[model samples]
Target: MESFFEFRHVYKGFDGRAILHDVSFDVRAGETVCIMGRSGVGKSVTLKLIMGFLKPDSGQIIADGIDVPLLSEAELTQMHKKITMVFQSGALFDSLTVFDNVAFPLREREHENEAEVETVVTGLLSMLDLNDQRGDYPASLSTGMKRAVAIARALAARPKAILYDEPTTMVDPMMSHTIADLIQRVKRQYKLTSIVVTHDTSLARKLADRLIMLHEGGVRFFGTVEEMDASQDPVVREFLQQDELALP
Candidate 1:
């Protein structure tokens, strides 16, 4: 099967400082691929490139058959309807209630009527066990609740692919598991292609059909979870060991 998303010889840098170098990978439709690396390893940068938030210095990023870098801003906006991102910060609107936040994408991008938006957002919030929070605002939510609300908002777009930027970061162990399980559930239910950028090896093991390990601006490993576990690279082993030690 051809790749549903691809990064070919991607190279990105900032002010002469290289961040990603010759990094390349692919994700098939309906597959969940986790990108894992230590902090500042370009994991989130990869996601930003995919979302067209940043451009690679020299590379070709193809998503849904569109050359992302080549698309105009307006074209990219339309393409965004099919590709949504859930930021690690849970980038919710402070002014909107949870219901409205989840419903925002549906209303703005998809232009679904109120009745349709009501049905979709209602079901999503309910599935995420966020029904009671619908009336609440971001300021009133805990870290986990805020992340849950972000996930609901991302789903409101009914995206073909979802990019999660550190979905489990800064959460307690229980909440981390909850977020991981929720991601798995959504992927299976929607058959959605997902790219999760996280440092949590445990979460990667749980949610990744395949793993891409980045080290020093390169792909150190890209294969099944078992392959990653068996990697002989010292960097890979050391990174995994460090994460294991960090667990409580």
Candidate 2:
């Protein structure tokens, strides 16, 4: 499979502190890659770079064959149509109902037909199991529900790739499972190129086709779950051990 996203020797920093140095990885077309690391390891920063929200100090950041950092504002806007990010906060419009929130992307395309918007939004809501809450506002929804609605909105854009930022964070155990399952379903259903940034090992196990573990601003490990489990690296084993200890 061809790469849909690639980062070569990417470096980023904030306030004179380096976050990522010589970071490199690639996500293949129609593949799901999970990025896991401790807090402050630049997991989210990687996503921002891919979205062109931030440019690397040096190195290539490519998404769908386009050099993301080199894209102009108008060019980036067009690129955004093909790739979408589901923010950790859900980022729902405070005043919009669930239906309108999901319909927002389609409406932005200037589709004059309300019926098409209804069809698309309803289908996405149904797929994400948000049909019952479609009339409600974001404030009334639980963290998981809000994330679900955010995903519905992302799907509404008909993006070829979707970047998920901590999808299972701050949600209950059951909701976490539900969210992970939803991500899996979306992957199988849409064959989307996906990049998920999370610290949740369980979520990573459930959703990752390949995993990239970052440590100290670089990739510590990159491989499948089996390979990760067999890794003898103390840092990798320590991270996995810590995750196990945290489980109830």
Candidate 3:
């Protein structure tokens, strides 16, 4: 199958310090791939590059047949219609209510009339179990709720692919499980091509069709979750060990 997204020999750096070195991977359509790594290991950077938020120092980043790094500002905006990132911070509009926050994308991107937007956004909020919070603002919601709103907003855009950055961080285990299940449900429901950047092995295990472990600025391991578990590579083993300790 043709790759829906790809990073071919991707190299990125800041101030002469390399962050991603010759990183290469392909995510086929409808497949979920988890990019696992410790903090500051370019997990989020990969998403930024994919989103055209940052340019690669060298190498190609392709999504949906467009060369991401080469897209112009206008072109990038158009490309964004097919891909959306759910930020770790749940970057919702502080001033907008949950319903409006979720509707913003449809209003802005899809230019859906208010009635149509309301129909879609209301269904999303109801489906996601945020109906009670629809009138609430972001500041009043819990971290998990904020993240759910962010997911709703992403879904409003009707993206073919979604990038999740450190999705379960700073939340309690119950909330993490809730968010994980949400991700799983959305992916299965939409048949989305997904890239989840996380260090949470449990989340990775639950969500990934394949896993890529990033270490020291490169892909240290890339294979199925079962292969990852059975690997003898010291680096991969170290991550697994840390993951074991992280579990309750």
Q: Please tell me which predicted candidate would have the highest TM-score against the true structure.
A: 2
Per-candidate count of clashing residue pairs (backbone under 3 Å): 0, 0, 0
Candidate 2 vs 3: which has more lDDT: 2
Instruction: List RMSD in Å for every model shown.
Output: 1.0, 0.8, 1.0
The candidate that achieves the highest lDDT relative to the unseen native structure:
2
Predict model 2's lDDT versus the native.
0.94
Give Cα-based local distance difference scores for all models.
0.92, 0.94, 0.93
Write model 2 residue lDDT over 1-248, tens digit each, in one string: 79999999999999889999999999999999999999989999999999999989999998999999999999999998899999999999999999999999899997547999999899999999999998999999999999999999999999999999999999999999999999999999999999999989988988889999999999999999999999999999999999999998
Model 3, backbone clash pairs (residues 3+ apart or across chains), number = 0
**lDDT assessment of candidate 1:** 0.92
